[model samples]
Target chain A: MSYVVGVDAGGTSTRALAVAPDGVVLGTGRSGGANPNSNPPEKAAGHVETAIREALGALEPASANACVIGMAGTAKLTDPQVAALFSAVWERLGLTGVRIVTDPEVAFASATPAPDGTVLVAGTGSIAARIRGRRMVSTAGGYGWLLGDEGSAFWLGREAVRRALDELSGTGRLGELTRSVLAAADVDAADRSLAWRRLITVVNGEAPVRLARFAPLVSAAEDAAPILDRAARLLAELAFAARDPGESTPLVLVGSVLAGPVGARVREKLDGLDVRSSTDGVLGAVRLAGIEAFGEDFATVPGDLPRVP
Target chain B: MSYVVGVDAGGTSTRALAVAPDGVVLGTGRSGGANPNSNPPEKAAGHVETAIREALGALEPASANACVIGMAGTAKLTDPQVAALFSAVWERLGLTGVRIVTDPEVAFASATPAPDGTVLVAGTGSIAARIRGRRMVSTAGGYGWLLGDEGSAFWLGREAVRRALDELSGTGRLGELTRSVLAAADVDAADRSLAWRRLITVVNGEAPVRLARFAPLVSAAEDAAPILDRAARLLAELAFAARDPGESTPLVLVGSVLAGPVGARVREKLDGLDVRSSTDGVLGAVRLAGIEAFGEDFATVPGDLPRVP
Candidate 1:
């Protein structure tokens, strides 16, 4: 009857899973965002606690032998005050010896049984993590939208706008990508000069990360092949940087940007390597919790839990 | 008694010059920043008026045949209210028929008498403008810090930080550029892992454009040659984009970034073209005003005015 609990605390939402010793998913729970950097510390901790409580609905909390929480802003917990908030959550849930790890580590675990590998996540932002023994040892390009995050959705969207502006500045006929970019920014194109200025104003008017909204347009526009190719190359370089020379371990690609054409290109660029895509990070957390409770071999156990849709 | 007035209304400060029809320096004035985009409309207008009034000295404002104001944010005057603010300044000074032009136009005029050419300005932000008949007809890469501004001081500084983070993530020796960047961020590199995280934190905590503070380090560090070379290439391309194919007009380079190593590299790249440096935009304003009042021949008038120190 013993079980383990796993949680994926992300910027937008939190998900938790309870798995029996034999690998059956006993329960699942969901809650609001729990990333402390984006949410109030107390609220973020409360969300984690709420999700964990729901996942343990009918099960006895004390019977859960191991618990693992994978978090997006794991560095935020380095602050004593923030750490104390999360610790209080664990205490309220009557849980002791709970482990906390970076979201990328759990994502890598979700993709492969390998204990060491590289995980590259390219959502609104991008980062590549070097995982050792199922934990993140180091990371590359997590500098966010302002500094780095090259090859990310933000990068792709920004490139799209830049290309559009270049076309606007020229006398040539506008291409599909440029046309779509202007349309998305709600700019009227009858006046090319005014449109150029308007597009910049519209993009800068919103939060910078919102530029990711235009990423899908780049994938759909055939003329944006260079952008796609460059994105793939930058992403591959990021993944390669997180790995050692000649060390071949599974590379797990996660997040929305990697789930499309960019991901296919990244796979082609990362050819000859064991590349896997992680769809459900909470499942990775479940696997890590299983490993902690039932030993390393538990990672290989088959489970009927489907990927989160 | 007839004289012409010229003003450079910039983001940091305003300068005005009253030049006699004979090209003699009659009077000069300086005041606070007058860029409407960065300063209150009333304040910006008041500064421009103050500078122009001082430059007039004991001369009758009605005797001023022509006045030209080169402004950093000329687009701001597109709004009727903002335009009225500037109009009131001209009206109060009895300055009839004053012309307002973009700062790049004046920069080009300051460097050469050419009516059509390219002007590249790369200070905290970067932009290249196509000058036609002593006016800015088109522009490129003026999307500001968020969307573009490639090869700007902000870009160089951001690239320096990115390189430092990349070296910190790898197992390689830290380069001089990396060391300088880390030091600039006030991050102690005793622990590479912690330093990597701290550098990102420090950068994200401040205004993004503040990254320009590290730009000088890029010029000083020999290891940052690639950054310098890329910056030069980007800036040169920007200038080229603002020109017609095989057009041989003067290309004027202006701003603080162009006054250093990056500027030297840019000049080298723009070889075979008439590349000139613009030190005092107010002088250019004076040249334009002279042209407007005393016919184009006045642009060739010999005078004892020295470049602003």
Candidate 2:
């Protein structure tokens, strides 16, 4: 009857699942936005707690021995203030063995048990990480949307909007996809030129982060077309950067960016690279916590983990 | 004596020079800040008009045929209302046959009269213009510092601040120049990290446009060693973009950006390119207006252009 809980607190949604020692997802639950930057640390932890409670509630009289949460803004959590706030929340939730780490770590763990691979993550934000001999190295993810965060879903979304505006203003040569995308964004020839500046300002200021949530839609929009070509190119860059020199280590593709058309485009752009979808962040977190709590024995797990929910 | 006037109205100073038909030295006048964006159109124009009158007053009583103003924000005069307001100021000054155009055009015109040439202007802001036939095509200059004016003095200044903040936060890898520059800005190691975010917010919110005026100082400071190497690559990019293929024509460097070390770096970056110094905008404007007014015949004039007062 021993059980465990795992949480993936993403920018737009929080997901939790109850799991048995054998890796079976006993029950699952979801909640609204849970990013620490958007929601306070206490609120973010509460969201994870609520999600876990709901998932465990689905399992009648269910119980969990330990819990681990893979969070998008773990950098913020490293701050003592945020950690203190979350610590209180964890204690209040009656959760005993809980560990929180970056979502990318979970993604890497879920993708494979080996600690020598690379993870290319492009959800709302993008970051590339590689693990070599127990050392974790990362490139470009300073503070998310505001500063650097290049090659992320937000970056692609922002670039798409910028290119669209350039096309509308005749400042940039329009590709087939860009023209239609601008049209879809409600910008036309007559009004496009007149409303160009204002619309561009508004789109550049707001739409990037929001449109990132629709990474799947953008991917779908690009299918059989050339809309997200630039995004695909960026994804290729991230993948190339993640590749190990002269080594055939797995290149794991994680997040919604790899869920649909964008992923297909990324694969096409990647050409001969081998990449696969992440199993699930929560599952990865569970495995990671297990490894930390139980050492090498955690690698002896017998069953396959569940796919991302 | 028939005299033509060229006025360069900047954010900090309003300069006016009266030139004779034979390009002889006449008289010059200066006034305070006359940027229309900062001061009311009439007030800004009044400052320039007063300066022009005073400069002309120093000359013997003679009728001037035409006057040309190479102004920074003329394109912003797109609004009929604003244009009309400025037009009245021009009429009241009894300045007839006046032509107003973007300041960069004047710099390009003054820099070279070779029907096809390019101008890379990096003053308070940055703009690259390619003049071919009768058309002038520009890259990246929407509206001063408010909108998009990348690769300009303001951009560099702002980047310097951001890099300093990044260095303090242990997130950036800036060289010797960054630390010195931040120290000069009164931001040091102890208060550097804490002051960074607030300073950036202040710079982003209010100081960008003003700090842009000090780009020359920043370039000068960087040029004296330590910082020159830091921005050499970026300056090279700007030079290359300005002298891209299909732009084999004569190239000119204009604005305060060309005054100090940045200019030297620019020249080094543009090594073999034909780059010349243009200290006077009014002369450039008048030279351009002369060409436009008289076409091919204008180039035949022998070393008779008016001196920049």
Candidate 3:
């Protein structure tokens, strides 16, 4: 009869899962983005509430023993005003003892039962975190699109664009990658200067994060090995930087960029570590809730909760 | 009656120099920042005009045979609206046929008389350009602070902060770099967690480009050699990427990051190449104007011009 709720408040969408003590997913609900960094605090909180309410769905929200939110940019909560807004939402939901952790923590937990490990994420942005138990204790290379985020989708895409620009400017050899990027940017001119100028204009017109949109194209390119090599190396370096010299722990690879060739390359580079992939962040949140509700630090993930891999 | 004008429209300030056909320094002018990327288009244009007006002093602005304005983010002028705004300002200033070039081009021309060469700039942002016939024909690694700008002041500063965070988390060795970065961020907390959290908050509060403010601290740190090594290596790679092997041309180093230890390292990396430092961009502009006015590519830089270096 008792239940716990797990939430994944991401930049693009918010998702919630209601799970029983045994880890059975009772219900699932979704809502708009709930990232405080991207959305207004009130709106972000509202979306979180909406998703949780729908997941609860007459299951008595007050009956839920605990709630854990796996959120992107949880650092926004460091601001008192933003934290208070989120707290008010929890109060209205009739939930207490709510726990919030960074997306990387949930991801690391989702991949393995290990309490301490490393998690490398490479979606729109890239970051690597060292997880201690269920908490992200340290991190490396999460400097965002502006500063670092090397080996991220953003970096991959930016590299692809740079290659295309070089080709258009007579500095790079013409290749299939160059042709595809030029066409994608709708630059038909054979005149390199004109095409180069147009391409720059095209990129600058969009939002900075949208650079990730071109990343998949690199994966599709015939000459993607170089980019993949650099990405994997950088990601591995980040994980290594977050770990002690002799330390050995499970490394959880998460996010879209890592799920493809880049992930394989990272796995190959990190030969000594026990490598795993996070299939679903929601499952990790559910496990955390299980730990909270039953005080089962070593509880095995429920067999019938759907396979993670 | 024939004269030339050269201007450096930078993000912090604008400077202009009037040079007669015989290399006589006629007048000079200074004004606020005129970088379109940093200022409103109108304000950017106004600053440019003010600098030029002051440089003209007693000389008729229309009497100049050629005017060259070197500006940052020249790609922004690819936008028709922004270009039109700048054009209007040029018309009002009676600057007929004002020539605008990328900042790297001016930096290269300032360093050497070679019309074709490579320029490496490592200020808050980093970029390498291949200059052909006094024009920027190709470029590498100018993706701005968001995507790349490797080996720049911003990169050094961001790396220092990252190293500090690692040390605070016990994942890295506590060293001079870590201690310096911690103190610089004003993270006086004995608790590593508190200090880590506070540094993130402080960095996020400022304009991302301002991260360059912490770069100088890294230079002062005892363990700055590795950073300098990496920076110099990356810069050399950028320049090489834009140069054809076996083709020898002057390599010009410019900006604060490259003016110090990093610059020495870069110089050491390119020992066989003709590497020189760009002391004044306005001097480059003056040379370009000379080429335009006299159709002579080989004009000596004026000796009596106020010391630019």
Candidate 4:
């Protein structure tokens, strides 16, 4: 009855799963966001422990033979104090040696059965990584929303607004994109100049990273085809940048942007690549734990996360 | 004596100058930042009024025949509430009519006394504008720090940090820039991976716009030649984008970036072009006021702004 614990700590939520050595689903749990970059260390760590505790239901704590926690913004934990906070959580869970990694690694594992591959993620932010033996050995672009993330959701959303701004400033022809952008911004203005200025005000009024919200509106606009084209090309370029040309391996697409119309466009651009979509990151965490506990062959455990939401 | 009041309301400080039709300096005053986008609207307007009222010392407020207030982030005032806030300040100053223009317009006029020319500004942010009749007729780029501002201080700084991150991530080589970036971030990790993670944490800790602080360090780096080269090329491209070929208007360079080595490089890139540096934007505002109140002949008012700082 030795069980392995797996956790996915994201910006919005935290989820955990426990699976026996033979892949019997033991338990599951979820809690509020546990990303220390977005949440306080004390609170984030507290939630991680809460989720793990709940997932260890009924079984003796020592029965958890191995554990893995995958978190977005894992770089934030590089600080000694933040690292201490999470390590304390591990001690409380009675786990002696727990593995922690960035969410991209787990996402890559969930999508395909490969020890080495390329992973392209495009959500509120975007990044691409080259995974070797289930670990990210190198990355192409993960400079966050400010420096890079060129083809991420934020880039596409900013492009949509840029096109509208250009049209409003008399550089380009106004069309459905302009209307959709204005409508999305809830700016009612008869004059194009006012609308243009209003859009800037609205966008700047919030956190700059939240610009990703407008990304969906781009898919609804006709002229957004150009943006989609650039996104797919940039995303594919990033994925290609991570892998050696002659080496053929699985290419994993993760997050909402890479799972939607943007993903389809990226798929077309990456025609010959072996591609797959990540179904659930928690499942990936479970599989990773399986590997760490029972070696590579056992890493492909029977589905133990069928009901994980 | 009849006079025109010119105000340069910036993010750090607001300066006001009163110039007589005969081009003699009447009075001058200064106050804190009044950029409504960065400051509270009420406080910004109060600063504007304070700067103007103090500049009107011992002079009849009504004697100001024309008044012009140049401010950055003018797009923020497009909001009715923000506009009304400034209008109240005008009423408090007892000004009959106040012309409000973007900072680039005033910067253009300050440099060469051209009624129509090209203005390039690259300080904390960057933008290129085509000035027509002392007004911004068209702009090539000014999309702010998040979306655009290609060669601004923020862009340069982000490039420096990006270069360091790339080096740490294996795509680039460690050099003077890497050491400078790491030292500036106060990350003392010996291992490259730990240093890379720490650098990302340091950057994501603060407001992204503040990355401009690191821009100056890039200039201090030995291998910043490529960044400088790319900056000059991109800036020239933007200025070129704002106008048609063969039309030789005065190309105005403003802001700290354009006044430094970066500017010298940019000048080298643009051979055979009429170029000038804007000493102070308040001079431009004064010239603009002189043009509005005094017809074209008086618009040639010799030394419209002599002592403006």
Candidate 5:
């Protein structure tokens, strides 16, 4: 059986999976911090290699024909500087061949079995993309915490902190969600200023992923407010913009944040739009690599990638 | 000469200027912090009274005619609770009639001597207003630093801090404005993170005006960048929105930041638009009170308030 590898590289962590021709998981691997934007190109590639090695070690005999890495900075993969670094690493690893794409592209491919559709990804960052008749069109937001990332985890997290500070200072008109989120986060009146300031610093400086991690807490407390309504509207706009108005295609929802209430809110906002939540992107990456490496109908094959033992 | 009192109630301090119908400055007063949103109505009113008393004390004998206070919390001035406190304070100080308007209106009047014109004020906060004939239209912003005050000193200061952080972290590819502003502010590499974070925290929290005071430094360092371009565009949009397109009226620029190079940038962006800058809002407040107290044909009389002694 032919083998393939799929990698999802993130800000603080990277997850890699090895799979067979029949779409069955063969092995898994993990590593720390692989975002190229955050580290040197060599260091980023090293992180990916570490993840691949760990995933391969899990298998008795590594059966990997080709590898596809879905990374955060793959949007710049085609750049001469970035491509040279990645190519050097791939060659050093003695891999047969490797394909690279942005993390969102892989997530979109994995979300739907269909070749042509749309995927709305909302995570530490947000982007919407449509794969229409072999061409991809996309819109990205959450460039960082500073600019406009409207409905992003960082945005919500920062808002929660700001609202808490406002409440403590008596300048804010408290809403139920803001109060509860602050309470659940254990921010009190005395330390509210300090905690809120720290949260803002975290959002502006270090890991914005930490803010996305609080998505559940913030979503659980969200009530019917203009702020939430505006977010919902923005999500719907992203979804609709990624979809073809003239053609009918399945709309898939990917990303962890989109798997829960935020997705539910998005779907509610879409109302009549065709959409579904995707289970896994790595699996989709494997299928995509198989189709590109083999043929278009490869996903139809069964028991392709069995767990190696 | 008919007497009038104009108060500029700021976040950290309050200042009152008593003027005569002839536009002659009579007296001036100063007091401490008094924002109704943060302090009780009684406390805020007491602060206002202290400021007024100081100005009244400068006069040989305080002229009693009419009073107009250009205050920060005039939006809530009409509220019964706040109104009652002001009324009690006015009676206690032997001041009879008083009219309250937002600080924006005062700035607008002060910026433009013409009875009908527009003023864009960008201080710690930002707001734009136009007086066409007898009607006034306005847009208020910069309540909190999180949402932003686009063209204000707060925005410029916070942006400087953000760019400095970006440069320190090696994440910025844009311009040198951030680095220059940081160096100008005397924040070094060792203290960069803390200093940057502190600036953002202070701007967002207790004293937004303090950070706003750094806007000129940012303006001095600003070059051609998308961020600065957007800021200029926002000012143009605000200016145009404040006035009717059919009518031709001078657009006055107020606030410390707007009086600098940033205002020139805004003016360039608004090429062909009638815009100019004014030195201070107190002057406009004096002019507006004169027009309201006397007839529209009142000459260029000196402000009536007793001069500071």
Candidate 6:
């Protein structure tokens, strides 16, 4: 019985699935982070190998005809060292024809069977990619927090701090959002002048991307509608930037920010387009591997490609 | 023989000027950086003392009845340790009645004799200060590079890199600004895909504020007009935010960004207002010290205050 193995390699964790050619789930496995950018290349590759090994389970690894890895930081593989590390993992696992693709490509594939579409991811950072032939061909606004990352969780958290500072700068009453922000930063609001200064210091004291921790507070506050609206608008603009003019294709919205209020607003802004939400990228990886093993018609196999929940 | 001393203590250098009651420049001194936030408190205080002693020039430090220091990062002095160091500098110099104020206050005083006005500073960071009674009472957008600092040199440089990334993300023609950004980042434009990725990596590899180094490139490129215009708009908004509605007091523009093309655009946006440029903050320090020593009317003393060049 021929089978295919698929893995979704993320920053914090990695997951793998092995499936028979007939779309039967053979086994599953999970491991630690495998993103080469944040994790050491050897460790990342080791995690990928571990997950795939577990997924193979009692099934013969040599029986898998194809393997696909949907990785968050696939760009890191451009480095020869990292590429070699990942290659070594495949060799040790006795896996051949291993294909590695960006998480966005898998995300788009997970949402729809369309070969061409747009995938917008707004997790800690944000980026929009144009997918053609189930692959990310180009991207927009993935410049990280320093450059862009507009509409990202990082952007949302930074905006929350800016709002708190703005409220503290004036004599007006502090809004609920400001109060929540001050509380989150563990800064006392008794002295407005000192509060703002302290808040700035606290935010700058940590890693810049850690600012994403404040993002959840934004959505929970009643006075944070403007921030949410702006985030949605920026995210929609980013999605459109990655698409061709008037090109109507499935737009897959992935990431935590898109799963809540901001995502709803983004959907409102993109009223005309066919929008889909993809939560699990591993399923997408499985679908891609299945297609590679069973040809294009495998995409239409109902039991083979699971629906994105 | 009762002269007043004024010092402008900045991040890169410190300058001191001794002025007579009638506004005649007595002696001048210059030294290294004295910003407590960037330099050690002891070193910063020592630099301030060195500059002031040189300005006293063969005269008794006790002869100066009043001394005013216009310092960048005056907030750093709020820390007890830093304040103690500065106090020690005053005592060692045998200087009494020493007063320290923010750079914006002195910049406002340098531009005009008005007791109330606005001061906009846009160097590596950006801020707008509201001056009342010759002191900064309130401010806008001085939240540092992490939170705000909109329209700052850092903001301009960051926008330049973003523009380059945008151009590289698409297959369209690269603009002059994009080419210049690529060159400045030392990224080879041979492969558009590799160039944009390389540019982002190069930027992330450095200190966040170092992005300000690219500000000059934005001004030098003709295609960078949109970025300049947006920066001007943001700065104008910041200046207006610091002023009360219909308040017609003088608006003093300070810092290197305000001395260049971005400054020109900001001035144009701020048209119909009382606009002034203040290049020498030390002169303002002298003017303030003269006022504190002689009387409020001393502001009009022609010989006691030199024109801002």
Global lDDT of each candidate: 0.90, 0.63, 0.82, 0.84, 0.63, 0.90
Worst 10 residues of 2 chain A by lDDT: A134-143
Residue B307 Cα positional deviation in candidate 1, in Å, after optimal superposition: 4.3
Better of 1 and 3 by TM-score: 1
**Candidate 1 residues B1-309, lDDT tens each?**
998988999998999999887778788888999999999989999999999998899999999988989998888999999999888888888889999988998888888877889999999999999998988888888989998889999999999999998898877899999999988888999999889888988999998899999999999998999999999999999998888889899999998899999999999998899999986889888889889888988876523366443
Clashing pairs in 4: none
- Give one digit per residue, the lDDT tens place, for model 5 in B59-110: 5333556666666766566578888888898888887667777766666665
Across all candidates, what is each one's fraction of true contacts kept?
0.88, 0.00, 0.36, 0.36, 0.00, 1.00
User: For every candidate, how close is chain A to the native chain A in TM-score?
Assistant: 0.96, 0.77, 0.93, 0.96, 0.77, 0.96
lDDT of 3 by residue, B1-309 (tens): 789999999998999998887787888888999899888988988899898998898887788899988998776797799999989988888779799988888888777877899998899988888888878877777766765688899888888887776567664467898788778778874887778767777887787787888888877888878887898899889889888888799888899988888888889989998999997888888888878887764355542356532
lDDT of 4 by residue, B1-309 (tens): 898988999998999998888888888998999999899988898899999998899998887899988998787886899999888888877898899999998888777766888998899888888888878878877878766788889999899988888788774558898789889899874788778767877898988888888888877888898998898898988888877788799999998888877899899977899988887888878888888887665555634456555
Model 3: fnat (fraction of native contacts): 0.36
Tell me which of candidates 5 and 6 scores higher on TM-score: 6
lDDT of 3: 0.82
Off by over 4 Å in 4: A12-15, A24-33, A39-61, A75-97, A268-272, A303-309, B1-3, B13-64, B73-98, B138-140, B220-222, B244-248, B265-273, B303-309
Best by DockQ: 6
What TM-score does the A-chain of candidate 6 achieve?
0.96
lDDT of 2 at A223: 38
Q: How well is candidate 5 docked (DockQ)?
A: 0.05
Q: Candidates' TM-scores? A: 0.97, 0.74, 0.83, 0.85, 0.54, 0.97
* Candidate 3 error regions (>4 Å): A1-35, A43-69, A78-96, A114-116, A171-173, A241-249, A270-273, A295-298, A306-309, B1-109, B113-116, B171-174, B291-298, B301-309
- DockQ for every model comes to 0.84, 0.17, 0.37, 0.43, 0.05, 0.93
Q: How accurate is candidate 6 locally (lDDT)?
A: 0.90
Clashing pairs in 6: B22-B304, B23-B303, B23-B304
Q: Write the per-residue lDDT of candidate 2 for residues A34-105, one digit (tens) a residue.
A: 778778777786787778778777453324566778887665776888888878766766667687767777
Question: CA shift at B108, candidate 2, in angstroms?
Answer: 1.3
Q: Quote the positional error of residue B289 for candidate 6 in Å.
A: 0.8
Tens-place lDDT per residue, model 5, A161-207, is: 55554454333466676566556555543554454544443443534
